[model samples]
Target: MDIHTLDLNFLTDEAIASFVVESSDGPVLVETGPHSTLKNLERGLSDLGYGLEDIKHVLLTHIHFDHAGAAWALAQKGAKVYVHPFGYKHLLAPSKLYNSAKRIYGDQMERLWGLMEGIAEENLISVEDGTEIIVGDATFIGWHTPGHASHHIAWQLGDLVFAGDVAGCKIKQGPVVPPCPPPDINIEDWHASIDRILGLKPSRILLTHFGEVSEVETHFNELKEILQDWAAWMKVPFEQGRDPRDVTPEFQAYANGQLKAKGLSEKEVARYDAANPAWMSVAGLMRYWKKKLGA
Candidate 1:
């Protein structure tokens, strides 16, 4: 299976990615990025001598805008969208999902995510955990790996796992950081998900945040470490009951400082921010800590 990564060219380069995997049946799309970069996705497919209509199967790692926002568009083009069973209703209707995102993104909603429409029920294939989906010679398994989002799934294609946010976000040589977005940030579940990914013994992992991640074991170890570190860091502010608006900037600076400590330049650091905004993490982790504390 030949895998190709398409740079969505999201806010900055190397921020978001969509992957095209070759199978005996045809081209299978892993992540669709956000519809805001749909043209870029089309161009990437065209460059590879295929078109959007040629994609018969689209496997989404999750329903996040960055990972699966453009899925409805592809489904409109007649692609069978493979997603977690928990995410089926939202993708089919999408009104509630779109409105929720509208609340988070507000005025920048269209600019960041574009218009997200609903996919036909027929085009939406909700897969059960550990379900094997055979598409020609390629057998893709959907692993329900939550923690990032309750509806998340890590699509396993042989030894390569298309890990969405569960694998966290890493750009270039930057440090791997967990993207704790609202409504679904489970530290315990995330740790378990990490263990599950490692259980697969993937030779390599593909991150939707950017591209391929080698050094699977080491990367995951680092990810687990950072996940704990960030959660601990958030615990302080959460206990203090500090307003998130006050903590977001501080956390952002702290995160950027970590990136700079790694010798990443301003642009690289900014790319990390673009990929995983600090404010969202602040809110997400705060909510997680609050719930854990039974607050």
Candidate 2:
């Protein structure tokens, strides 16, 4: 299977990407990105000699709007969207999902993610953990990898894994920072998912936040380290009963500092922020601690 990375150009270049896999039947899309970048997705496909109509199979690693927001558009065009069972209902009835995000993004919803519409039940296909879905001659096995989100899946295709946000966001050469959005952020589960991914021994991992990472072992190593580091760091503030708003900026500075230490430019740091916001992680990890500690 030939895979092409389409840059959604969200907020900044290389911040978000959608993968197109060439198959015997047609081009299978891995992620449609948000509807805000649908035009970019179209142009990228067009350059690859494909079109919106040419896409018949869309494999979503998760149902996060940034990853699968434009999926409804493809489903409307007769494409089947494959997603985790937990995220199935949301796609079939996206109002809840849209409203939840609207609460967070407010007036910037349209600019950040465009519009979201419900997918017909017929077009929504929920794949259980370890379920294999074949598109043309290419085969994709969905692994239920939660931690970042309860509905997350890591799509294993051949020797590479479309790790979505489960593997964290690593842009260019920046350090891997896990995206711990609210509603679902369990550090223990995320660590287990990382171990499970390691067992697969994939040669390459495609991150939705950016592009292809060839050094699989090293990439995951950093991801694990930072994942724990971030979680532990958040514990300090949370245990003190510090307001999340107060902790967010501190965590942001800590994350930004790490990026700078790695020699990333100011622009590079901003791109990382675009792909995964620091404030979200603060909220996510804090929520995780609250649930576990029963605070």
Candidate 3:
């Protein structure tokens, strides 16, 4: 039951994935970094005295490319990939996902994410809440905690919960930020998911964006506060008929100022920016607000 943080030198310094529980029954590799980082992942496993074959289970918190893009590679190595039921079909057939991403990323696709292949159905395992999976002697309880994404899952191992993005984004040496990607950013559901994780009384919350955070109580509170503030701020501009594209810069400026006030140095703030493009959140929140208004 060892937890290894694999720092993915992607577009940012704090980008990381947690590989948890290595033993005789074989290690459970959690959250494979994006497809472009396969070499780094292989080297990381080798350095840790474990090869791809040593991994029997690849548990994904979600099907987002940054989080589960490498699941196909791991499945190729015989690892049984487990994910939320909603994301099962996407992994088995990623053509739609890839094409959608391509539309958003355009020419930057390859440079930003590299190639994402489809996972075989034979290696796919769809899980739901309360489903306890036993790898070796350790039991991991899955919780269908959405908000960050509809396909999100949070795994409870012992007293620590591997919170993919339910707890928000906590970049190393930066203000605790939220990754609110578009097409799905429900503030109410996000808060509910936060409460769900807190109720577990986990001693520590492990974030896929970076490292382990033991100040669960304080961390979650701060995350909730900032998330609400961001949402509220976005509402005014949205209701006033401001253009979504025009508001992105304002959002980034606000976020940058907030990060500075939180004691992040210029270099640290750059790290945060690299980890999370602030403008993306602005677009996401705006979209969420528009959807709510329409409903």
Which digits, one per residue and each the tens of the lDDT, describe model 3 over residues 1-295? 6778887777656686756577558778888888888788888888888888778898899988888988898899899999999999999999998899999899998877778778888899999888999987778899999888888899999998999988777887555788988878889888999999999999998898878899999998999999999999999988988887888878888888889988988877777776777777877888889989962
Model 1 over residues 230-292: C-alpha lDDT tens digits?
899999989998999999999999989988998999988888887788999999999999888
lDDT of 3 at 37: 83
User: Candidate 1 — which residues are off by over 4 angstroms?
Assistant: none
The whole-model lDDT of each prediction reads: 0.92, 0.91, 0.85
Per-model TM-score on C-alpha atoms: 0.98, 0.98, 0.96
**Winner by lDDT:** 1
Overall local distance difference test of candidate 1: 0.92
What TM-score does candidate 1 get on C-alpha atoms? 0.98
Cα RMSD (Å) per model? 0.9, 1.0, 1.3
List candidate 3 segments past 4 Å from native: none
The number of residue pairs in model 1 that clash at the backbone is 0
